[model samples]
Target: MSGHHGLYRPGSSVLHRLPAQVKLVAALLAVLAVVAAPRHQIWVFGCFAAVVGVLVATAGIPPRLMARRLLIEVPFLGFALLLPFVAQGERTEVLGLPLSIEGLWSAWELIATATVGLSLSVLLASTTSLPEILNGLQRLRLPALLVQIMSFMVRYTDVVAGELRRMRIARESRGFEARDIRQWPIVARGAGTLFVRCFERGERVHLAMLARGYEGRMPMGDASGAPWSAWATGLSLPVLFGLLALTARA
Candidate 1:
């Protein structure tokens, strides 16, 4: 199945060739390493960023596309930017402004960790299709229920969105504009109605799946797991970074 609404860009890069499971696990490890690194070790984050930059370049995704994808970080950036002013700690003056030292460290940590985590996730999505991500989670022995929920969520979110769009178009076509607060109930009721319709559709879909022998699991896909060389190749960066993190603590 094609990716429903994923960021996957087709390519034959080394990342695209690696098994989804390997890439997923390696990305997780990379994010964890970045998160666990000492906040004072700013250089480690730079190293992690460099590694991600290399992957982005190798994947053939344009930098503008990556920068746009990273826009999701804006909300986190706002919160991080607020931390230094609001948090309490030993204060230091920066350009005649008082800032809490601990808060500054916290802000740095938040931005660095969140940026790394989000970038790694974007890398995964850019390289692997949505279905493959679900498959990888299943291979990792993630709870079957959680996996199913995610699978359905990924599959049906578009349906829900389309339903919403249709509803909006219908409403607008009929001159159902909310000109004031008095019309708010109409919008709320429409939203609730949409939910009920979606719920009923989900029930129908579930019954259909059960009719076709869906015995509480999705059919397995290509089981040819990553080769040992792929593991060594895919994990090399994370492992090297892990060692660097360890050495930095020494």
Candidate 2:
């Protein structure tokens, strides 16, 4: 279990150099465009894929890593795959299987929407560091309290997860394997212990924060220098959207 969540991976790509604020805004806009898009528009979906593809390529992320990270969606994707069979609509036979036309179309739309949203999110996260992302949110005028809570959660999630892992390992070493369904209560108790430990750790962290001038707000760092290529790269999505509109309307 690595403790790295939302931490920046150092890279020299244009996306890495773009201001976090700009990337956050662009990501949001892209998401909006995808979500508000016409449901049956294949061209819009193609454009969305193209824009994400360009960003992923520019970010220098390996395709295999991207696929592996995106694998988290497979279970949901499996459900989407089953939709065509279960959904009620006009029936069509494909390879001796009865499939609903409306269901198949609905499934495609859902898959496209999920794919676009997930790809944008992963690309943004992979390119931008967590601290920078928080800074971006702050710049965008997100509520101070919400930002603070999110920052702390991202920072401490790994710590909590590590604690849980160690507890599990200790239990396993003691030959405490559950041999019956009735032993679930023991597992529940272990979970309760983990919660208490995490709560104690949070209190200690709060004390540590108090010792260090404990301001409710995070201090903004020096302004980051933006490179020339960032502007061009940032606008790529809009350009892609324009092209998509043209094709879709035609």
Candidate No. with top lDDT: 1
**Superposed Cα deviation of residue 130, candidate 2 (Å):** 1.1
> Please, what are the lDDT tens digits per residue for candidate 2 over residues 21-44?
788877877776677677777877
Look at candidate 2 and tell me the lDDT of residue 160: 82
- Assess candidate 1 and give its TM-score to the true structure: 0.90
Report the number of the highest-TM-score candidate.
1
Q: lDDT per prediction?
A: 0.85, 0.79
Q: Per-residue alpha-carbon lDDT of model 1 for 191-249, expressed as tens digits?
A: 99998998999899989999998888776566566689999998986797787677667
Tell how far residue 185 is off in model 1, in angstroms: 2.1
Model 1 poorest ten-residue lDDT run? 217-226
